[model samples]
Target chain A: MKIWALQDQVLNPIEQKSIDSFKAAGGNGSLETFGNDPYKQKLRVAIGSPNAPDVFFNWGGGNLKEYVDAGKIADLTPVLDQNPELKNAFIPSVMDGAKIDGKQYGIPMRGMQPVLLFFNKKVFAEAGVQPPKTWDDLLSLVDTFKNKGVQPISLAGSQAWTELMWAEYLLDRIGGPEVFKAIRDNGAAGWKHPAVLESLTKLRELIDRGGFGDNFASVGYDMGGASTIMAQGKAAMHLMGSWEFVNQQDQSPDFVKNGDLGWTAFPAIPGGKGDPSNVVGNASNYYSVTSDSKQLDAAKKFVSTTLHEDSYVQALIDAGDVPAVVGVEDKLAKAPNADYTTWIYNTVKEAKHFQLSWDQDLPADDATFMLTQLQELFLKKVSPEQFVNAVAAR
Target chain B: MQSQRPSSWYAVPAFAFFGLFAALPMVLVVYLSFTSWQGLGTPTFNGVANWSRLISDGEAHASMGRTLLLMVVSWAVQTPIALLIGVWAAGKQRSRAVLSSIFFLPLLLSTAAIALLWQALLDSNFGIFAGGPQFLGDPDIAIYTVVFVISWQYIPFHTLLYQGAARGIPASLYEAAIIDGAGRFGRFFNITLPQLRYTIVTSSILMLVGSLTTFDTVLILTQGGPGTASRIIPLHMYITGFSGFEMGYASAIAVLLVVLGTALSVIVTRATGFRAMSSQQEGS
Candidate 1:
């Protein structure tokens, strides 16, 4: 049986331990791991063809919506019903994000990636600024940084999805979760909402304010291009997911150690209905058994191992992620950064709503078009109205 | 026709391979073009829904237009410089070998490696050329930068071809031209240009098709962003098929692309009067 997973040394020991146990249980399977790529275009083709892997790893959200709607993955609700430990092991909030109409299709397998505003404290201090508490303050800081000859925000503008966090947060804060809920739950017409237009308009304000400097459209998130700007003190802040901190730690340890990297909620926008505390990101990665799996029993058995094991939850914490498993708080205290881990856990815990990334939330086609629109809006290529109309048609 | 015709059996293996791999997939793509399938269930016939949508897809059209622009820009920049260098190098003795090696260096590096190197060099914060233009950033300038990089790598190839073609011209031709009171420009326009037509037509065809199908480099570099400024036809097709999961519409685009390529190659070959320039000249 082919067991596919994303490449990460973080998963090496975990897989070895899991496979060893599976073998001990008289289960024989072969695992093929793709590299630690955020996007798995090849896997899409593989899963559609006859040679689909028995089980595959994925971020649980609208990312799985297509597979679920097409009946490509087995509904795991029955499996969870029989295995209460598996159902109860993962944080309930994170689990909801992976389901469709209360039916579980995937098992939470990895960490929570809540989006946050990561800032350089030294840059803020040097510029006599603090992390913004309101949208206006964030707006002024864009000028403040520009005056100080620094980029206001380090944006990986070329990678449209990287620029997506800004829109996600801004929309949430301005129009409230209902604005996007209608769009996602209601389909493309959600793009035509006044709140979406307002969100796009506000995002433009940040761009026009010189928030992301003149050359932002070229920068990419991979290989530390945008992070380098932040680490090298060329930019004051970066709006990114929790993984940004870990990436910063790896790319420039000194920056992580001494640059006083900081985190904050996206500022509250005036007239926005969204609670400032609400956040957006993947709830957790998941493992789903393919519908066509020849080794159905083995695949289901192997994937359930993702949740119930305490050591697996602890392993995620050690990898610099704040896992959303119940009874894992004590384990988090032993994390790489206990305080940061707590902040992440609580941030996710305290939020009234947690939005999945639109690109990951919407069906694939709309998501692709929506990302293009978002990137275009950020770059001011299309007017906010045009963006909304274009998306609404999708 | 049966008189001394090469045995058809000799072509069987190649024909079988092409039939299974290339011809079969192409047939599937064409058939799939009229259907709706997201790579999940069996493709259901939609009766030109995919084709009709593609006809009005402004983004795909713009991407195709941009690809044509890339072809024009690359051909204009790469072909002339390569021809000039190839002509000059054809007369050189020792430097020709060294120059050829130096010019061919970019071709050795994989597209991914080249993109990474350029990403660093053009990086706004840490790149060596960061202070200059945003090489891969600014949408207005990004496509041209891609064109420039592509030319930087491929000009050497064209140059080598041109060099071979140029050298194949007899020394007696140039010596005869000199005796006829022809100067450098006159001799070149009269002799070299006429002799290198076949090489030029072949390379131009290659450059056009390669530009239209450019994917890996752009995928690694800009990902066809800054509002789709750098999106070429192949990139558009890949994004539509894989990321969008609109495999039917994407297949429509693919079929259209194949048709376009074939039409272009045929038209270009005909218009250019494409013919090989051999040691024994056939009068044009």
Candidate 2:
């Protein structure tokens, strides 16, 4: 059997060990890995060819749904039904990411990544302000940071997906996840939801107020862009995924070590319809079996047996990942970077709705178009009404 | 003697390779343009839906405009610099040789390396130009920045081309012009410029087509960002096909590119009389 997975230094070694254990357990396979963009393109091409991997790693939601709809993915509902213990081992909300049309096509295989508003604790202290807990406070803090000649927020606007976190959290907070669900399930017409315009108008106001500063459009998430800006105290706050803690730990160890990194849930808007407990990000990555695999039983066995194993889950926590497996609170607390990891674990545990990233939740074509329009929206090239009209018309 | 000439069978391998790699893919792309494919399962024919969509795609139209701007601006910027340096470097001076080698450094680096290098150099906060103008961020300036980086990468190559061509110009021509009391500028115009005409044509065509398909630089540098300001046709096509998984629409865009590229080169060759391939040296 052939398996494909994402390439990451910390994740790959752990996965390699899992693959080794699977091999030792009489499951035969080799793992190939690729960087993010290349992996998506390769998987898309591979799924259409005769050489599709028996087991493959994929983002859940609309990304995987396309494969499922084409009859390319095996329905894992029966496998989960046969082994309820295995099914219940993972967190349900994260697991629901891979559940399509009432059928489980993938199993949760990695950490939960929820978008959080991270701040430079030292910067906040020096500026005599706290991390915002409400929408009004966030706006005031934006001014406070700007007055100190610090960029209020560090946003990696070059990559649209980075900008997407804001939209996801905003829409979820303003009108709940139903607005996006309508867009995802129904089509472009759902983009016309009044809530979308309202959320975007709020986002546009933030942009116009210089929340992200003048040069944000060029700042990237990787290669010392926004992360570095916040780490170095040139920026006061950064809204990013939980993996950002690991990235900061890797890129600027002293900043994380000095206890200067801080995080909180996105602020609540007054009179919002949604619960404050709602969250958004990549829920988790998953492993799915291809329907046409030659060694179907072996592949399914490998996924079901290895992912939720104590050793695998422990290894993930050790690497600073908050695995989506349930009952890992104690393990996360005892692991390295315990403070940050436990916070993430609890935040995810309490979230009323865990939204997969909008890009991952929408079909690829619409997601691609939406990201382009999103960048334009952030650049102030399009107004909220214009953004809504353009997307809805699609 | 006539029997020693190679038979037509010698052309078979070359023809076979071209047919298999180039012609076959072109035919497939054209076919795929007529279907709806999401890069999974079989492509289903959807008639002229994709073509009609392409005709009305405002983004694609903007991308075409950017592509043209990139081509024209890069050509305008690279040609004079490469030509001047190539002619200057053609001299057999020891100092010139060292300087020319330094000028050729960017040519040795991979496209990915060059792009990344410039991306870091122009980064808004941490880069060398931090706090200066937002070279890679500002929408109005991003495309020009792309043009500049591309020229920086390819100018060395075109310089090398012109250097070889310049050296091939007979020394007798310059010597005769000098004997007529021609100045440096006069000698360059009367002897060097006309002699390097064919080289300029070749370099211009390469520059034009190369900029037409320039993808990796913009992809790495700006990613058509600061809000689609730097997105050109090829990048737009890539995002549509690979990122969007709308393979059929991307194929339509790809087919348009093929037609445009072919027409461009043909027009250049025909307009400039480059296909004549006649010798420039007198009494050769």
Off by over 4 Å in 1: A25-29, A36-39, B1-6, B275-284
Docking class of 2: high
Model 2 over residues B45-164: C-alpha lDDT tens digits?
A: 999999999999999999999999999999999999999999989998879978999999999999999999999999989888899999999999999999999999999999999999
lDDT tens readout by residue for model 1, B140-223: 888998898788878888888888889888888889899999999999999999888888888899888878777888887678
**What's the lDDT for residue A164 in model 2?**
95
Predicted structure with the largest lDDT when compared to the true one: 2
Q: Model 1: which residue pairs collide?
A: A174-A272, A218-B137
Interface C-alpha RMSD per candidate, 1 decimal? 1.8, 0.8
lDDT measured at residue B106 in model 1 versus the true structure, 0 to 100 = 86
lDDT of 2 at A68: 92
Badly placed stretches (over 4 Å) of model 2 are B1-3
